[model samples]
Target: MKSPLVVLTGLVICCISIPILTSVVSYSNIKQETQTKKNTSSQSSKLEKNEIIKKVINYETVNKETPIINVYNHKLGKVQSMNMEKYLYGVLAGEMSAKFDIEALKAQAVAARTYVSYKQGHKNPSQHKNAVVCTDFKHCQEYKSYEELEKVNGSKWIKNSYSKIKQAVDATKGQIITYNNEPILPLYFSTSSGKTENSEEVFSIKYPYLKSVDSPYDKISPKYTSALKISNKQFVEYLNKSYGDIKLTENNLKNQVKITQLSKGGAVETMKVGNKEIKGTDVRRIFNLNSANFEIDFENSGIDFIVKGYGHGVGMSQWGAEGMAQEGYKYYEILSHYYSQTEIKDTY
Candidate 1:
């Protein structure tokens, strides 16, 4: 019925149409795949940028003006008020300045801030008699007043006797206490008689009427002594002789140490002596005095004296700070002396 030429033309048209349709479908699929890959790449790039931004911003910037809560206990009921700066200073108290990493410090600051903020204005009227028993370290018994401390120990005056504790508390305003930021109670004593076994035993035998019992870890203690022991007169003389040209005054004697100006080392707290900078830990090797000797039995004169703690024997002994605060020293003076230049600014 159909012509041979018509059939041939129809077959040609079919063949042409099939190839064009196939090409269109294939091109469309390829374009779709390309778009998908581009989208995925763009998303990945965005994610990388976000991560970089996060890394760049510090905690202070990210969580600006967040409320700080100082929790008195783990119970979450008793709390005090503080800001991030105050809390961080409290947490980083006594630690060398260089040891602080900003991010890590911020995290700690947040936790302390929360704890203190939660405890604000909590008046439970609980007996101050709840003593902190030191399981890891020995603590002294709590005394109501200086008279009570004297009655128990035979030493009447704790004012000048424990002057370092008072000075540190006065200097820092009680915000920066705690060795390593662990909460500890403060114990007051007339002397350091009950601090060590040897000291306690000797005091007990020497003074039979005195009570040589361990006291709570108060900010005040008998362990307070100078880093380099020269008599007050000798110390002044050393300052006058070493730095006679520079204006010397009793008020500036403590602040006159040029070595304190240097920033804390990355891993080591150091001081500059002459041309050589020395680690605070190593200063004992260069100087020696009978009074400067600590933690060493001088019975053997040849042996090197081993020191117990670091820093000058003034203010909140870092270990003593936590102890005193746990026993309860309001957080103001803690920040004062430890950091000479800084003030406790409210961030919240």
Candidate 2:
């Protein structure tokens, strides 16, 4: 038989050993779980880092080069190929004044570039004949080479101005305005009569981004207001020349002419002269008025045309851009303001 003291000592030892064994197993389980969590977190971090690296590689892999464009020199009647960026320098010189703010010039550059891209995509083979665009202001955007610019502005102006124009072009290189992943028409004009017109109202084609918008800063344009007085006989003769034979007399001008419709932008849409209905655009063309927007007042011996603004008044206003730039708006911001629901995208 065993001693009672010995038995009691054994029982005490068992009690202490049981707790130690339980603690060891519990600690082992906790360590394993902690290791598993650490491994998962490390794997997630590595995957995130790998994704970042892949994106960096993809961005670095793309190579961009300046595009070459074929321009038809309408005066010379020759197609000339040159760098697109160089073309923009000439376009900026011809379209917008060099004295404009850098931001405004940049905005014009992007618009001109987008215009070229859009035209290139929808090439009127008959109009340009293998040329991407023409130098004619009536047909395509205006473009003036360094030689032409020097002749027009003098060598002194070129020395002081060309650098700024080049800077504007280079700063926004390979950028174009896009709506719905396509280049927009990018129409622009000298000024507006406080607002822009919808594309449908002016061009008979509707575009969502080309909706009417307010442009109150165009008053700064020198062509904002103009007046021309034409004698009753001259007015009647001009109308007759354009619109076949119409029953109209010099003295009865006030009673015979009637404005039939006005555009939402407040420009004349149609007018009736005697028995003939003439489009406001046709009238402006026949009379050489500054724009389609005009008001006719009958005078004792003549008719006076009071004109406001210039150009088609259907898109970005040049003077309005200058005003926005002067107000500290960035080029992109100016574009976004003028072209609704559009995005600036890099062209590669």
Give TM-scores for every candidate, taking all chains together and pairing residue i with residue i.
0.22, 0.80
Stretches of candidate 1 exceeding 4 Å from the true structure: 1-6, 29-87, 93-104, 116-347
The sequence of per-residue lDDT tens digits that candidate 2 reaches over residues 44-107 is 9999889756533111222389889999999999999989999999999999999999999999
Clashes of each: 52, 0
True lDDT of residue 22, candidate 2? 100
Q: Which whole-number lDDT from 0 to 100 does residue 306 have in model 1?
A: 41
Pick out the ten consecutive residues of candidate 1 with the lowest summed lDDT: 134-143
Question: Ten residues in a row with the worst lDDT in model 2?
Answer: 54-63
What is the alpha-carbon lDDT of model 2 when measured against the actual structure? 0.89
Q: Give the poorly placed runs of model 2, Cα more than 4 Å off.
A: 1-63
Best by lDDT: 2
Q: Model 2 residue 216 lDDT?
A: 81
